[model samples]
Target: MQFTQIEYFLMVARLEHMSKAALELEISQSSLSKTIARLEDDIGVPLFDRKGKSIHLNEYGRIFYKKAKKALDDLQEAKTEIQELANIQEDSIAINVMNSKLLPKLFFDFYKKRPNVKIRQYVLPDKLAQQKLIFGDIDLMIVINPIVDQRIEWVPLFTEEIFLVVPKNHPLATKESVSLIEAKDEMFIVSETGQNFRATENHLFEKAGFTPKIAFEGEDLSIILQLVNEGKGISFIFQHSFLDTYLDNVKILKISNPVCFQTVGIAWNKNRKSSFVVNSFRDFAISFLKDSANKDFSN
Candidate 1:
């Protein structure tokens, strides 16, 4: 079957309506129908069930659709890789990251050093970023709690302490540090479920033998901090120099008992071949982080 036929099949499989798929594909309904029929004939099995002018994938169709979609995706990825290879001198580096706040400085520093290198950065949740790295959709990832996978390698960057944050006027705000169990009854603001920070917070609470009463859950770190500033609830945050800007009405309390923290790292898939620009960027990032770490210690 033609590659276009596979493309049409996937489109029809997704929409499950011949007329709708035809409209979206900008092809005549009859032509789309013929392509689907020809595809089924070539495979020697009826892929879809037709009833009352609507068509839906049957078991055979569902199985074929999954494999066909993956095949097309692989082809597209190959084409992209080929194009990147052909234009290696004007390379673009794609990175998936957890923290976007650090990217502006990091990207600008890299750009200043290598003016021709293009950087594409994405700030995604922990699990989604890991998925992108594993799928070779991105060249690298900056993340916390790097998942242990044989296909992926992690380079340790640094570790930051996780602190319990509270509104300045809260009862526990005056203390230098507090235990998770001490605040067990207090309402907590936390990141959404799949994030690394949220998971770390949950683990700390669980270790303290209690689950926090979540008052609010958000995807944005700034929003979580805002909720704390509003005295909605207390939450956990990584200790960072930049956090001072957001802490005018909030207090960062140390976690004395569990001493919760997360290790940040750069992760990349070992199976994927690195282009010259990708390698150079990776080396530059490692050197930059090392220098920054040394400066932090010297200060």
Candidate 2:
């Protein structure tokens, strides 16, 4: 019925023993028992199954516990939002980059607007970025496949196709588009296994129904492009990555069977109190990426 009652109920639900829950809650066993009894009376349901020294939540109690936890979460989120709105601080923003291809220009554009603000950026693997976000070590994450977490909020910026790249002289290069099955046996030059782009392309492999035969693993995009150019092996990359660059003997082709694409997004830890600079950058990134996607689509 009340916040304290709900909180006590949740604690008891977690611990499943009244005396243990009371000890942990720093309340007397008698008081805790009376409060829980009052709560059950108000709710008009027997919430717990008791056997002298042992206690466990019944079906009604289980349902109530879930709803109570969610209600508390909503209230906490509202409180955090209000506090952030009331205090607009201009702190340095820390960002992590998992999808690195598009972030340079986006960060540069933001830097131009807020000339006095400092924007710290780091390129990290998937797991480390998530740990940093959870611990409040980072403010924003630019990623293709955003981390899925209840406390993390993500906003989509743009989507781009992942193109198959091969040496221009390769047989498949002559074809406009071919299914990944067409080159199932070809050795693949790829980024290291755990990188974000590699992870996205890994899904394409799953959809295409085969694992790639790896010829080499390149640490950077240019290395992959170079290896592909030499006819060493074929690779996959984003369409927008090499749009302005000249590909001497490399061809960016399309896979028709299972279309490979990734949606890039900006993610932040909603639990952290973001500064005005970080929020403004987030707003600016949404618009800038929308415009970029439109312009690229038109071209």
**Model 2 / residue 43 / CA error / Å:** 50
lDDT of 1 by residue, 3-41 (tens): 999999999999999999999999999999999999999
Candidates in order: C-alpha RMSD to true structure:
12.0, 11.5
- Using TM-score as the measure, the top candidate is 1
Q: Which stretches of candidate 2 lie over 4 Å from their true place?
A: 1-91, 98-104, 242-247
TM-score of each: 0.65, 0.63
Candidate 2 structure, TM-score to reference: 0.63
For residue 163, give model 2's deviation from the true position in Å: 0.6
Error (Å) of candidate 1 at residue 119 is 1.3
Instruction: Show where candidate 1 strays beyond 4 Å.
Output: 1-88, 100-103, 241-244
